[model samples]
Target chain A: MAALLPITHLLWDTWRGNLTVNPLQDWTFRTGDWALRLLVASLACTPIATIFGFKQASSVRRALGLYGFGYAVVHFFIFIGVDYRFAFDLIWDDLATKRYILVGLVALLIFMPLAITSTRAWMKRLGRQWKQLHKLTYIAVPLAVVHYIWLVKADLRDPLLYATIVAVLLLLRLPWVRTQISKLKYRRVFQKL
Target chain B: MAPKKTIMKIYSSEITPEQTYYAQSQSRRQFFKTAGLVASGALLSACAPSTPSTVDPAPTAIKPEKPVTAGQTDELGDAITQYDAISNYNNFYEFTTDKQGVAQMSAGFVSSPWKVQVGGLVNNPKTFDIDDLRKIAPIERIYRMRCVEAWSMVIPWSGFTLSNLLKQVDPKSEAKYVRFETLLDSNRFPGQRDRSFPWPYTEGLRLDEAMHDLTLLATGIYGKPLLPQNGAPIRLVVPWKYGFKSIKSIVKIDLVAEQPTSLWMKSGPSEYGFYSNVNPEVSHPRWSQSSERRIGEMARRRTLLFNGYADQVASLYAGMDLRKNY
Candidate 1:
């Protein structure tokens, strides 16, 4: 339900012609923006649940991942179907030349295996290996952030902010790092004693 | 009522394929209208005091508050982007990188009582007041402006030819290039503080390119004086080149022996070039220029060589490679 907001707004804007001068660009940006936001959100669930001791928060991680993949597919479809008109040669050229597009495509492909095996049946079939394979999200999330970084021309504030957020989230997920942080907080207390 | 005349027809050659593409554009064409356009036209017509508008004899000239005759170009049937859209959404990076932020920031910019220095390798070096330029140049033209970002718009611009201004200050035999400099006031333009590239933004044109009839030194569009955000007082309008080539709020015009390095060319030599012509065949390093989204329209149209002015300006690049130069 939360994921439908970007989709709904896109529909509303398209209907009213509310998108800025470049409607295609506006549409592409919004869809891609949401996909990245959701990817980041899914990555947060584990650390957020562990740190806050909110066991129930862990349940929404798969849902967020699936929804992010949905938006990713839409973003990819818009690029190819509308922007390129399914021109394979043009797509090939963009993929070859544009480093941002290449990174973005790699990010999208990373989500494919995780999304396909998201269902309970596939999770059960894959068993213990599923957890290790899904760890690829750590790599995918950073690539997606890098893709955003390359697209921006001058202003780096927004992209830099997102990078910082993703970096912090990744740090919180590392068990060794979390233990070190926990010890640092108590280190000063022990010295007082 | 003022008589609307088809001003000057420079190109007599056969219509190019690119021109035909604009005529029979695949997408549905919709040019939006704004109340500002009609309002400005009426205001300008009311302000003119029955004197001839073409040439003011004195240096202390009145602001060009009147509208120039903007007649349609022959065989160019693309619907124009309305006054408001053209005025609002733009890439005047001097003010701010944010498209919408420029208007507010540039409101305090004092363009009146401005001086443009025309110097360097020219036979005669002189600085002309902005008002004086208004009195001398009264030609207006409707042109299609395409940005390097793969977006475009058609606008009715009121101004005069760059050649007319260039001829006034005759170029010396050694002058191979014409370099332009925009007013670099960091006080008003916050973006100037960013030292990512050189400040006092610069652009250049080969001597022959500067002499082209299509090149214009525009003062206003849709009737009234150009809004502060739209490069108030004066700016360049190079139709065939990327919109960045049309530097805003120009203050300096230098005729140099060597090809002057423009802002983008200086910063990113690979991505931007000296000859930034509109070409469907040659793509930007990051994005494809094969197609562009017309500002008011929903669908993208295939980009054109010299922005459909190939027949007129292609001769300037005869026997030379465009891709390599680009």
Candidate 2:
């Protein structure tokens, strides 16, 4: 429901002509924005589970990852179809000439294998190898962020916000950092009692 | 009596051409007068709808303007961009970064009580009232405006040649460049608060470029005085160069011997240049300049050198390397 809200709002906005002067650009930007937000959200699950002992965090992890990938697909489709008019010459030129677009494409490719093997059936079949394969998300997540950072002109606020969120989430993955956060919370509860 | 036909004829005779003329006279310009009401109909994200929900039925005290000398041209057959599209889709960053919001912000602005300071390296330094500057016999020119961001528009602007104005000021022999500054008013123009760019946006042109016949200090468009968001009172309009070269809400004019660096050049020198002439061969460091998406149109058209004014302005840069300067 959360993942679909942005597209739903955009559909209403686009239909009502309530978007920016360049609606096409705004539509593409908003969709990609949600995709990054959810991708980073999915990564935050592991840290939440370690620090807060939230058992349910793991349940939503796969769903969030899948939702992010879905939006990324839509974002790429908008760029090529509406923005570029599916012109092969322009697409070819963009891939070669624009570094950011190339980076975005590579990031998408990295996430594809992980998405394909996301189901429990494929995960159990691959066994321990699944754990190693899923580690690619760490690389893919940062690459997606880089793609967005490069895509923007001057305003770095949006991209920087995400970069900082992803940084904090990554830092929490450290055993010492997670133990520190856990101890802080435990101390707060003890003081209350 | 003559039944249905007679009644229809009688009603048509009563309303007729005089009613149409009366309506025209009662309004300043069809668009500017109703601009405050625009937001109620359509809204864009960056800009508030400048139009009020209810329009004033009566016209203000502003008098009818004299028609500018219409310079005959072989029409490019390009459709005049829709008035709303031209006005709504703007980069008047002084109001806000979002082009849509300026319309609302500018409707409250008083452009009539305006003055332009022209001094610097000139023999005659003068500050003309907005009304007096409008008096210097005008001309109509339809020019294509190509933005650095790969969007384009065709505008019919009303103004006399910039050379005519420059001549009146009489630039001194040492003056090789002409620099312009936008009005500095943080109270009205919120964009000044943005530390990302230097305040009171500045732009410059070579003295020769400023003196070109095609260069105009546009005062109006669409047979009406320019709307505030559209750079009311007076603004520079260099049709051949990128649109940023044609600065808006101009307050001061300075002539200098050295090439004056502009706002964009200061922000990202690699991306913007001192000479921002439209050249297809040289792309902006960030995006392709080969094609531009016309604001209301779908397909992007290939951009032309000097925005297709090469025959007139090409010789101005004949010997210089465009790529280096670009």
Candidate 3:
């Protein structure tokens, strides 16, 4: 429902003939927003699962991560297809001159490995290493935020909001949060005894 | 579905005798029209070769205006192709930033009722209607229009020189710049309410630039009344500068003593400058201006200096630092 809202808004604007600013810019911004939302949703899954004692909500984490990957791919392609117009020369020029585009390309490249290894079979094969490799999201999230902040000129409000959300989510996974989880587990074990 | 079928059946059967008679009569009328056309065709064939052919000569047979002078061949001058001339029209951004949208929405403008208010530092502030302005001397000049967006067009525009028009207004010695304001009717222009950019577009030129011979208060393009999107009634066309320098659909031409605030500059000072000349060396902050894709020209064609009218306008910017002016 949350993803549908922004898509509907974009449709309304397009129907109203108000898509004057390059469609690529609109596509990139919307995809980036959706990717951030998905990442936030993935982080919220564990909290919701613990609070409600419903393991089903945690099952959505994989889907949310994949959604983030989907949107990131869309954002990357929109930049290449519309902005660069598939001109290799122009793309090369932009990569050289625009540091933000370079950082964004790098962030997308780093996310590609995680996206490819996201399947259940690969997860099972990697076993314990799967959890460690997937922790790259911690790095990828902030890098993506920085990429967005660098791209925008004189408008830090939206990027700052995303950064704040990602920061809070990451902070929620600190040693204190682990100690609290351990205390809760100990209380549950003692209560069962 | 059954009810709809019944409704359609009744609608078709409702036709009375009088309606049927009228329908039959209409077909008969059409037959007579066809017969008349056939008879005219036959008559034309019969008279085709006889009586030395009294039919009127082709309208194009009329004597050409400005006949070629002695020893002057049509091939002597550098000819701009008709396709290039037609397609290279610099789109006015008032209706919409989309090049085609400007062309579409301009049709709604009623240019006949147009009036221009000339005020500010001018001694004789006056308003001139479309007819009043047309009565003045008209000169046709073919010049290139370069857009700040890195596209360019060459156009043959017809209008009186701005210097000649300015002489009537008699600007005070303090008048150092001329600012033009486009018509601001949101009802007619849907793009006015767009928040993406400012509306009631404004542009300005230095006093000397305004008074230059290359500057014109244009009313027509391609020898026709200016298209609505092309700044009908009147617009300022500075051939050597970017297209935005030529403000369109001008409602007011203010002879300001001070440097007038320009719309683009006020919105983003770094991106737009006051004197937006066509200099390849000085690139726009967001994009390069070294080359422009001339609309409808082959993509590989090189951009020209002063957009290929350098001989005419090169002297205008001579001794001036183009980078600073740009």
Output the number of the lDDT-best candidate.
1
Looking at candidate 2 chain A, the ten consecutive residues that score lowest on lDDT are A89-98
Better of 1 and 3 by DockQ: 1
Per-residue accuracy of model 2 over B215-286 as CA lDDT, tens digit each = 889898655688888888788999778888899988899888999989989988987999889987776545
On TM-score, who's better, 2 or 3? 2
Steric collisions counted per model:
0, 11, 0
lDDT of 1: 0.79
What is the overall TM-score of model 2 with all chains considered together?
Answer: 0.82
Q: Write the per-residue lDDT of candidate 3 for residues A1-193, one digit (tens) a residue.
A: 3555666787788688555333444566787788777867887777668744679979888888778777888778766675455667655654765566677777778788898999989999999999999888888878888877876543367889988988877876788986887788889989999
Q: Over the stretch B1-326, how does candidate 1's per-residue lDDT look in tens digits? A: 11223223322121122222233343313111122334444545766654434433222211121111113333366755655577778787878887867777777888989999999988889999988888874665668898988888887677888999889899999999999999888886778988996888899999999998889998877556777888988999999999999999999999999998999987888889999999877877566678787887766677888898877788899998999998
Candidate 1, pairs of clashing residues: none
The runs of at least 3 residues in candidate 3 whose Cα sits more than 4 Å from the true structure, single-residue gaps closed, are A1-193, B1-93, B195-198, B297-321
Candidate 2, after superposition: displacement of residue B47 in Å? 43
The residue ranges of model 2 lying beyond 4 angstroms of the native Cα positions read A183-193, B1-74
Q: Per model, how much of the real contact set is kept?
A: 0.39, 0.08, 0.00
**Which prediction has more favorable TM-score, 1 or 3?**
1
lDDT of 1 by residue, A17-58 (tens): 787767788778899999988888998898778766687778
Q: List model 2 lDDT by residue over A1-193, tens digit each.
A: 6778889999999899888656667777898988898899899988778777897997899999999999999999898888778777756765776778888999899989989999999999999999999999988999999998887777788899888998888888777987888789999999999
